[model samples]
Target: MNQQLLSQVMASCVNAPDWLMKKRQLAVLLQERFKSTPAAEKIMAAWLANPSLAQLEQSVGEQTNADQVKAAGLHTTGWVNLPLFTAANAYPELLQENLMEKAISWQDSQLNAMHLALLNGGRFIYIPDGTIVKEPIELTVDCSLPNYHNLVIVGAGAQAAIVEHQTATGRQPAYFGTELLLGDGARVDYYQSNRFSAVQNHQAVRAYQAQHSVLNMYLALFDEHDLTTDFYANLDGQGGAAEIKMVTIASGQQVQDVQTQILNHGPHTVGNIVQNGVAKDKAVLNFHAVGKTERGAYGANSQQQSRILTLSDECKGEADPVLLIEENDVNAGHAASIGKVDADDLYYLESRGLSEHDAQVLLTRGFLLPVLNQFPDQKLREKLVDELAQRLEEKHE
Candidate 1:
């Protein structure tokens, strides 16, 4: 971490917990002052150079209303990453141990020391055994920093949905990670929507499932100057299944990379990933989906599907979906494709008396819009639609 930049960011820190500082100190020691990995080095450089947070602070005069945040059934933190409100009064109680650590740490350590020291506090949602929460829980994060350690736990036989929205102005940098665990027979649906402009964003998701549980995730990344997301899951429970679906729209020098991996350790476990991306202007996008079924995990099933629709000749997109099966009894497969909007379709729509712009927009929508079905909530679906429209309206190549 850059010392001067760290001081500037820390200036906004509010009512931070005591344990937070203690963990941060330890993280500082483990901070690997010289990042050995190229990726870590690049991330650190971005954090140091980002000016989004300071610029946002100068533009927005007032903090968002706490009541509105809570009323919307959101567990949210302010720009400084301090817990500002929790909807349904699901506060400290629901935010169990930093399962970002594990089931019973009772304290924070250096494992995530760097982020602990950099972030305010994380969102924690723990679902009890056999408890079915029909209404989806929404979490709103109004952060400008680079670390958000969020966790979700679904007890045995329980079912729940979690929707997370990250909104910020400017193309600065936003980096965060989420962790989820599902006990035996549990079912969960996780969805995320990011609304950022011209940013260098890095996002990560880690999940573990117990026997006979099911986990479904839907994510929408509107656009950014540079964006990367990594998804990791482990099917540790027999008969457990995981599905990840994602949609992205990028334009104007944007770069996007989304990768996923599933470690199959339980017999009869299933994992699948599906993603659709739209590239305009000179943007670039890449997708890597990997499924590895360890030996003895018999009867495993894995699949992947990915496609990219490039709007301009200058844009680039690639998809690499791979599966490594160590068990002969398992079923695994993948499909990927990249193409441009059909000129014949556009011409036919134009000959029907529609404007050229309208024809292209309609075609683009037809190609990339169906992914919205992944969202379970109508309101969320509408919200994402609006955001997508704004991004698509930007200048195309």
Candidate 2:
């Protein structure tokens, strides 16, 4: 939060582009403007007040090596990938076209501004126009020192898939921001797995879609920490479509606030949001899902479903679904609920000779089945299912 430390961090980036520097400066101004604003969520107040600004400052002058980055699971093949800061400094042309112009908004929140100003590590992935990538781009994050901010761009008519994993680490504060921009007719299937060891983690993902473009985002969160996530999709061009689905498991006294927003701003656009979460062992989970159809968006459609199941008496959960319809020609509706597991289903499973714990695990999986079915990769679905079962059993034991 000190000016001297911020200056040192900015100076550490060697030969960074002037435009990028201007962005950093704008972020600082935004941070100042929102300093007095309270976090929207009460649970995140303390964490947002001191969200690892010092950690980002400490990362100044540190150099990343091929070996270290590989150890962190950052090096990948079969796609155009580069270190985030390195890409900004060395290859500005790749990002100059549409970096923050549409993907991210610095004026959104103080935390967002701080993220851009203190960003020190991440990856940039680019998919050229008309290219069809047969395999999903795989990425992992293990090093938490570098406040990571990733950017991904998909050119017109391109189709690609991306999967990112966050491995366990220390009990440190961590921040990650990823913005995806899709050109006209582009299609992207993006998935994220959050299982990091940070005591407090802040994450955000935003997508900007052009005409006739499509974006599907899937999030599997199992972080046993205080976690706040912001996921958004903007259908900015005619005929654009976007769907966001999230499945989260909160256990061991964890607190999670997950917000997903979709805006239908173009004619004939479509947007959908589905979120499911399970809370056990005194954990708390809150889901906020919003679907909005802007004015002049004739024939736009928006729908959302948010549900949460609390498995323990001490555990708490909330599902808040909001719908905003500005155009009379639009169609929008939402469903939200926070409830306990169904007893009849559990009884039926137990009658089939399954133990109570086994039956509960199966029921949990079934609750998340809707979102699971939306994943494009079958292998990933199986993997996540197994991981979920194992984690549930471990927590119960």
Candidate 3:
């Protein structure tokens, strides 16, 4: 690591505690393990020259207060009330060990300017081996600046399960990036929901899974915004499994681009992806899912599916599912569909004395329930369902 870069990172973290400063120093020292890839260098440089803590504190203070934000019926909890501090304190050991083991890497070539900023921004999380945390962990990323970047890293070990919820609430144009690593025999369950009002930008996430590990992710995007999300997972150990499910609702000139990839590198690995999207009022959504199996990954099984429901003549949706198989013994397939709701299904529901609007809402809720059903926390699941209902009402109105 360059002395100039070290000095820059040190200066940027002036307000951070001594322990965090030490962690940063350790991260810099560990960066040498990865080949000096361009992406890695860019991430390191940006982190070094990142803004000072005082500046971030002031920015947080100057943001629109919780009581001032207005988005449909969505209410804002105070910054302190959000789970930022708890998330920061929860996973230090997990991330530190991954950083030490060279199991994590960064790529700037795939990053946009906002991504670069997000990489330099936000808090960090880590989870160690045999940690069985049942409570869902939640965090809110509020961007007060016109353009900002935030990055979160999670590491899970053997027999570990974790749930994370991230929400973004603010008016500023923003970029967000997240990278997660699951160690051998680890089990992780994760969920994220994003709602943006009067914003234009993208959000990206990438994760890597090791041997005998399992990962499940649920995502939801509602309201008017332009978003591009990229997700990549590498199954590096035999018997590893990855499941990704997403639901997106868009209205009023919103556009969303989704790209996902699952790579099978170990024998007998398994991967599955399921997604549902709805576009209305001139909204457009593009979704893609890809599964790739290496030659050595014999007996690997991968399946991907994407379904979209269009509610307006002016709305458009595209679904793409791709499979790349290098081993003849592997099992891999993809399914995709983009269309309007079934008129016959609606007619049948209407015959049961349900109003058209009520029927539509009921059907939409049913379409999303499969993903929500995977949540282990009953309280969180109910809260999310209520939020979804509120957003759906806004769309109808």
lDDT of each: 0.68, 0.77, 0.62
Task: Rank candidates by TM-score, best first.
Answer: 2, 1, 3
Q: What is the lDDT of residue 169 in candidate 3?
A: 55
lDDT at residue 197 of model 1 (Cα atoms): 50
Clashing pairs in 2: none
What residue pairs are clashing in model 3? Answer: 39-108, 91-126, 117-149, 118-149, 118-150
Model 2 steric clash total: 0
What lDDT does model 3 reach? 0.62
- Order of models, best lDDT first: 2, 1, 3
lDDT of 2 by residue, 1-397 (tens): 5476357546754456787777776776667666442333331354345544332211222446544433333334334666676666545776665565567776677777666766566777877788788888876767655267678988899999989885636455666778899999999999888666667777888999999999999888866677888899999999999999889888888888888999999999999898889988788899988898999899999999998988778989988888888899988899998989888887899999999878878878888877877787999888887777677777532
Prediction 2 global C-alpha lDDT: 0.77
Which of 2 and 3 is ahead in TM-score? 2
Supply candidate 3's per-residue lDDT for 321.
89
**Which digits, one per residue and each the tens of the lDDT, describe model 3 over residues 49-149?**
55322222213233243332212112122111212222223333433344212322332332342233232344444444655545444545554432232
Instruction: Output candidate 1 Cα RMSD.
Output: 6.4
Q: Write down the TM-score for model 2.
A: 0.86
